[model samples]
Target chain A: MNASTSQDRFCEELTALLPRLRRFARGLARDPADADDLCQQTVERALKSRQSWQDGTRLDAWVYRIMRNQWIDEVRARTRRSQTFTHEEEGANIGAPGDLAAENLVELGNVGRALARLPEEQREAVILVLVEGFAYKEAAEIIGVPQGTLTSRLGRGREALLRELGEIA
Target chain B: MTVSDDEFTAYVDGELTGAEAQRVAAAIAGDPALASRLEAQQRLRALLRGHLDPVAVEPVPESLTQMIAAAAAEDAERDMTDTKQHEPARVLDFAAARARRDDQVRAARPPRLTLPRWWGTGAAIAASLVLGLFFGMRVADDGASVTSGGALVASGMLAKGLDEKLASANEPGKLRILTSFRREDGNYCRVYDAGASSGIACKDAQGWILQRTVANGAPERGAYRQAGSAAGELMAAAQTMAIGEPLDAAQERAARREKWNK
Candidate 1:
């Protein structure tokens, strides 16, 4: 395929992936508005830099990596401005109405809240692995960490989350 | 021996191979606590998936698709235009000529004294004299009626230009405006951009001072039509004057509470 044609196909594929991307973004960003904004920014950056993509590779991994970088960039900008939001503050606005099962919704809300409590690295690992269903190697690649480190983060993150949600003794 | 949390996670993720998985299963089967812990991990995974599954199934917004399509179209146009402007042979010839010129200059003898250094010194003195003449003319023009010191002193057309023309907010695509009541270290800061450059200025006992300047891409000219143009420049000049770190969130909030009166 010509470069433009290939880029068009990539856009089509990315369009199909948007809902899942939004879910991953929502998982990371507790506020729905911020989550949508994050997803939009990621998609925009990906589309603008489509030349960087290699053919026959996993498109999902490429998109996720872009999203992760966008999130980190935003975090850095916010830090430069000295802005911070606590987990409680972040969670206060996220529970959507009438769309999800109540128990499941509450669990999701708790998970979102729990996610905010995690250190940045652990949260990223958990999001990529359990939430986004990336394989360990893919998750590690996306986060730019070793596979062993990713697993360790996931292990610690799950334990901490369980404790926070009162799921542990 | 019982399996650890990490081992259970590995097994659940299928990271453990043949014997390792079997050993973990055996341990789980034999140990009630281990079995419960394993179940808890399984439940957590299911819980997480259950909540996230709806999001996965949620329809992609139409607006996002449209935006990406538009961006792709724009990129294609840009690439086509670039290709038309630079034929391969012409580009190679241009590079070759530029390389020859550079080689000639390198081979040329150095002047007895460097022309740039001599010119730079002369230019510096001339610049100071011009500044003095301009200000002197201004004083004479105003009949010495206006004292050229303090906040009011920095309130003329030049000051206005410094405030309005030097900001990034006046730039086209990458306009940014920052306003802080007080920096984290307790100084006021404002940053703005114009065209290809952005600058930060700070306020102190000395007056508004320029701090840092950075040049990015060319800013949009259309931004000048906005009411914010002058304000943008003032903020840019303020950023140039900043001292210490820009205000932290808490300090900025406090400064805002005071209405930036300082």
Candidate 2:
């Protein structure tokens, strides 16, 4: 590792973001395999574009931007294929959540389960703002939405998640 | 003051400040329903964070992390004069495909040369360790590989390791398969560590052709790799020759079935 290089520093911080990246991916994709695949793409994209990232800026927002863009691309691709490709948990992923193998790894909490089942837009808002602790403006920027639109999605997502978790409880 | 749900959402998210925040504070204090709604968003935030924070801490797959570090490190290590010709960035750009190798493989310079049986199969230590020197297809009278018109051809144990060993099946033996990948033109290649030395070989035509060799010089292993390790240098060579991600065990097994053609 080039300890003194700025690239090294960038990667170090990027490595630190893995957990939250994984969590955000899981939230957005709603499938463990997809989440990991998303996470891998995000890291790859982030690294490839490491030069474009301005110094003294928040790496989290930059990475989240790359992640959501890749995911949006994936979601768009899946939407197109939804009619023809029966797209069950992709062919090679070991286990999707709720599968016995994944269940054995960690028995997911009820709130986590409810969050996973939320609608895509709402899930994105919830994960960015609530789960990732990003401010509304930052979350909006990451999602490429206006603050007003972001708040609306957050409100709807929050209400649905509350209702869903209430049932799970 | 009846705070709209959007205003309440912003307030809960800590985005509403000063007058609007104060207004929400007063409303929540006076109305149990408002207070409960406020508490619900806060609870959800906590719940969501609680649920997701653990994933960030979970062991990041080594491949993902290493990809970033090694790519950057190699980018720094590469000589400026090497090649200005650039290939498009690919997610599968995991091989050490230097331009020369790509050109050599593309032109199909020579008919496939057969490796001599005298090259010695099985766990033979690479009799020499030429660390830090890229002896381009430098053939030995009695070596694991020989060059035919500058392209390194794998013979002996190196050839056997490239043919049979899989990195996924990491058994401690004399031959250690580090990784396998395909080049841009679609030939399969592998990096290996055998006793004292390691090198990379790409399967061209009908057999494993050694592309480059150094004394255990495989770079770009992972970012955590110590700088200038001979093992890393070998991988660095492999990286320039590859335009695809390393073959996982299944892909490697599949490649083997096809004898690594194309």
The best candidate by lDDT is: 2
Q: Tens digits of per-residue lDDT for model 1 on B27-46?
A: 88999987887778777777
Per-residue lDDT of model 2, residues B209-250, tens digit only: 767655432232321122124444555556677674456455
TM-score of chain A of each: 0.80, 0.79
lDDT per residue (tens digit) for residues A61-139 in model 2: 9999899988888876765555355445552242222222346235556776676556667778888877788998899
TM-score of each: 0.50, 0.52
lDDT of 1 by residue, A20-107 (tens): 8998887766556777899999998888788889977999999999888888787666554432443655534433211233454455
Q: Candidate 2: list runs displaced more than 4 Å.
A: A1-5, A85-109, A167-169, B78-262
Residues forming the 10-long window of minimal summed lDDT in candidate 1 chain A: A93-102
Grade the docking of candidate 1. Answer: acceptable
